[model samples]
Target: MRTTKLIWTIVGAVTVVLLLAGVGIVAALRGGDDEPDPQAAPGPGAASALPAPPSATSPAPSPGADITGPLDLLVIGVDTRVSIPDWQPHADAIMVMHINEDLKSGYIYSLPRDLRVDVPAFDANGYGGGRRKLTEAMSSGAKVRGTDKADVAQGYELLAKTISDYTGVDGFDAGAILTFDGLSRLTDALGGVTLKIDQKVVSQHRRPDGTARKLRPGGGGYTGPQATYLPGTRTLTGWQAIDYARQRYTAGGDYTRQRHQRQLVRALLTKAMGAGLPADLTRAEAVLTALGDTLVVSGDRNAIEYAYALRDLDPSRLTLVGLPGDSVINNGRYIGEQLTPVGRGFLKAAAAGTPEAYLADHPKLINK
Candidate 1:
């Protein structure tokens, strides 16, 4: 009984971690661009790609093709550090949130950052296609000729195309870029997010004070007493949440980190919805204000419209999916990740707007 319980607990933790990478952001920014902030600087890699103001004339072509119903949104979490210029950022976490036609039920899953895929040719960023790790698509697409600055929006465009091709979807209805800095601010605005941990994780990146852990003299890993998170329910501050989400050195490595990230998403969404934040004008405004710094969104509808459309979406109804896969090591060289046949089939069902039907048969794929 004990062994069975532990196995299920781990499975549940992994399953719930990746849901709502975008939902939480959508819920938190429900107020949208009603009042723009001129003083707030755009997030790193956030440039002119932001949506233009509403116009009296016909709208231009959307950055991505719009889906009328059963939309798929590519949500990317980037480790965008502004401290270094000319540093092209990679998509640390890539997720697709599929909202069924009814908008009541949804499925969320992550594409391994190191997954091997053939990135399509994107002329906008001068990326001539080739097979590479999935994360490189964003780094290659974000580059601008004769400029050191990276365009995160362009990166997202290429990534969306890559994912669309990979999943056999026409195109994404919308997309969002979540930066580490923005996530922290959003969490703080919500007073802090509470999450359940099924296993103990020690931070290898940050100290207990949220500062960088020192490297050993020759440098293979950090040399210090690490910040430890024990198994239990814990409320994490903005930095703590981000730090926890960034941990990939645990037993499950990146997969474990992925689980924690989705868990963070679930926690954020729960806090945003249940805390009377929408009704509290002051807190709502604060959450919205923090959003400007948190997300770079692109879709036919603005942030407000997306939020409103999903307003009635029940967080409980969303399904957290775990795609099965294994690392690809070629000639003893660790290359990337690849989904098994079953995982690929699951993505097809998800793209076709029938994941629940598919999950009905393959119960193991459902994270819960």
Candidate 2:
């Protein structure tokens, strides 16, 4: 049987939004067959420790009602090893989703990982305020004194605050942390994603068979036969999808990677909404369990509940925004990235909830 509109209520707007950050809850709501079980909830404690919604004081909506928006959500993807004790993870990917008041459309944009900015002091970690790469905010904030384990939540808090300050946004209404492992599992859970590769890219980290390339002697870089992707539409497995999205050595550098990431999110959402997920009970269970294990959501409501509220959201309406930047240099050495004046203007417009207007004037910033 084909998935009906009812299942859409459970896989709604936030599904695409969360996909940008590698959070997977679509499988968590699936029933034994093609239809979704409305009563299903994500695994216990999947969402926790998040701030209340912007309208927390307002009367709560009745069951199955959509929530009002004009809200901002911050998403961070970190590549940290679980086996390594006291490991401090940096933000490998930082993206933001801004929802319009109409709740019908939204804008998604990425901040370059190497963008240099002022990271505020974190009392918990004794980090003094200083200029640093945007990626370092999370690592600096995650530091703990003595035997205290590294705190990812605290890291997220710092990263969100830094981004909010930089973008002129008052604050983020919701946030999520996506681990590297979760990303692979989520992609695999959906069977795979079919995306159009904009350009040819060669892997700098992996070999042809999807195994890790051997490290060069003395630790300069990986060495082996690399995987290469040609420009075209192709269905990618989890690892291939991630590797392709992570290519920064391409022509456009990090900007190209950012564009690919957004494209991957759109493809994943399109597949899920088209009822492309597996109908078998065993596969569905594995997807749900893997998603639950890797996702950490921060919001007033659980991810499943949030999905219901965003049910009317049309993923097709999302606009992918790219902020152009130039390399920051000092003493003839590249230090970091700095947004161009146009990029700054875009951020200002986004904070004012008028990104659509800004993009209309600066169509070049809109990613095709």
As a whole number from 0 to 100, the lDDT of residue 197 in candidate 1 is: 79
Q: Give the TM-score of candidate 1.
A: 0.79
Candidate RMSDs in order: 13.0, 11.0
**lDDT per residue, candidate 2, 1-368, as tens digits?**
11111111112222334432222334334422444333443445656565333432444443324555766766667756667886787887788877777766787899999999999988877888799999999888887756557777777778877888899888876676665556666777777888888789999988989998998999988999999999888999988988898889999999998888777766766665554232344544555565664444444455455454554455578799899999999999999999999999999988777788999999999888
- Per-candidate TM equals 0.79, 0.81
Tens-digit lDDT track of model 1 for 1-368: 00000000011121111212233334545445556554354556666778544444553332212323466666678756678998887889877777777766687788889999999999986778999988988888888866888987777678778887898777766666777776777788778888887788899878888888898899799877677888889999988988888888888888778777777776777777786654565666666566553333333345444544555556677677778789999999999999999899998887666777888988997665
Worst-scoring 10-residue span by lDDT in model 2: 1-10
Angstrom error at residue 44, model 2: 39
